[model samples]
Target: MKLTTSKGARALVLVALVATVGACGLPRSGPNKREIFAGSVLKQGDAYVVTVNSRVTRATAVMPAFGFGSSFRNAGVVGSDTINAGDLLALTVFENVKDDPLLGNTGQRVSLLDQVQVDGQGYIFVPYAGKVKAAGQTPDGLRQILTKKLDSQTPDPQITVQRLAGDGQTVSVSGAVTGQGVYPIERPTRTLSTMLAKSGGIAIEPAVAIVRVTRGGQTGKVWLQDLYENPGLDIALRGGDQIVVERDQRAFTALGATGAQSLVPFESQTLSAIEAIAQVGGLATSLADPTGVFVFRNEPAEIANSVLGRKDLRGDQRMVYVLDLTQPTGMFEARDFLIRDGDTVYVTEAPFVQWTKTIGAITGTAGAADSLASVGSSGG
Candidate 1:
């Protein structure tokens, strides 16, 4: 019985060995060596060029009126010597006015009125007409006031008042518009858009793209885009008001195991980790080791010294973040983690996978050789 049992055991062992050898000889179902090789080469790195949508919001284009003919009409205080301040006036009192020698034949050029400056004050400086305040008064208004003042001294004293330089008017233009400098307030009805066009419009790619008006120390942000949407928003600009155009500076980068890795432009001003991942075409399913996904960033040396020595990092030396996505929640954190410019992302390959593939290849080759030998023997 022992001999029979041992023979049976030997036979069983032989059968098991034969089954193992036959199984090895059969073609494997998964991707072939050539296919895997091709896949490995093709999927090795991320694509260099990637398409990103532009952030600028498109609006309806409107044809603006062009040429000097469309320019604003010159009105309100046009002449250079129209009016000014601090000029002496002459108030002349003609006794027997019609018979006065100064009123000779023609009364047009007669010295009928005279006023003069006194005590450094803006008043008609007359011989006996002390200081009369003419600061806030216009030419006509000053004329009347001087007439009253001289009349008090001498009844019906003809008076004329002219300004030296009209209160030094000026307008300030600033913000995103070009040529941000003070412009002379030539007209009181200058439109905001006209001034902007004169100053070469707003800077390109402004952060805010909205012009802010600061007048009398009050601030307000106005959308330049709105001007096209609603024409009324392009109101007339006033003196001492500033127009500021804010610049936009929000961006993110895509790297690592994605199909296309590039700097993706975002206008939302804030880039979420999830959005960034989608921007780069997501991770490679077959090759990417989801567990080994990592983002490298700079941190303070003092804080990182506990986990990694200061010598590990170079210059302005700092910390390095090592993230392992093996845990289920790690992916969630990665989705939440904000990516900045110049950030490096790495996706590692699965461990021991290459070894298994190598062994499988060796076994396949041995099986093919054995099968060929068996066929040769049969043919012989």
Candidate 2:
């Protein structure tokens, strides 16, 4: 069949072709306002479409609570001055008898014993003083015990016990820190914050930094900032404790007509909807529909019930929260609305965008048809 080149026939064909394109639907970032409204629970879709309001903001304003529990908080600071098994002690014995010194040579009144390790059974052996319990005792306490033990062997023997920094009473600091090593628990580094400092402090941002402490079989985690803000969270360090500092792994997905589509990490302890939008450089100005900003999340049963005002919902519920920035209170509602990990913030394209795209398609088609008509007329 010969192709029609007449202007009248071409106009009719262009109208039909445009109609087909319109019926098939034009390209869009995501669902429009009407399509979103149609997907509400009241409609055929399973998602609950809620308009952002003060109530919805409060219902979803929950934040992650990262801190120590009662067990960790109740623990007292470890005594840095106290002696423990595996610790090295330096002992000095001073005797008044110069002629017959038991521990020292003749004319020598002082005897020094270096690197006296406390045994696993918490006992330390001294020459002529025998075995004495040293793990639970302080340096001064051990000295008094040694003085009494050696009084029978030496006349008025004075003893001094000094605790040395060793592997015992130490914590292993690792992960996101300026320095990662085994640090001794001293008077200044007996607590969580002080120990972190002794390791050259946290290497990550304080806002997103998490401090995890594992003592024995139990482990506790708290935000690095909270560790200082809340005194109770800064628990004392213990022997054989493992400390790790790391960044929060929570993030959300940005899709549709936002400035950029990617996984955005939580930059602060708490994130609001507006802040999240800003983190992605806000919406695409030319294509975004201010009235069609949506947040997609699968809320827990408890939060879903609170949001929908119905207790019948169980398990995770798919929810789409709509924000109309054109309204007077829309900006405020978005400001108060909190974003959670794994949420998807989507901004639909303006309704006019599809129409403009359709127009461009129609014009391009017309231009091609006119060129074909000109070529056919020339051939005839």
TM-score of each: 0.35, 0.94
Compose the digit string of candidate 2's lDDT tens values, residues 1-380.
34444665567667777777778877777778888889888998899999989998988888887777777788788777799989999999999896979998999999999999999988999889789999989899999999888998888998888998655788999999999999988889989999999999989899999999988888889999888898777788888899999899999999888999999999998998899999999989889899888999999999999998999989999999999988999999999999999999999899888888988988887876676566666665
Which has the greatest TM-score? 2
Look at candidate 2 and tell me the lDDT of residue 341.
92
Q: Candidate 2, after superposition: displacement of residue 355 in Å?
A: 0.9
| Candidate 2 segments whose C-alpha is farther than 4 A from its true place | 1-20
**Candidate 1 lDDT by residue in tens digits, 1-380:** 55555455545554555567546643322222233233331356211111111110011011122111111122223333333343344444443344433333444334544334422343444445556665546567766765665565444656545543323334566766778776643343256666677677787654236666665655655556655566555655544567666654434555545555666665433444455666677666644556555444443343233233234543333222334455656555555555555455544444445556556665665565555545544554
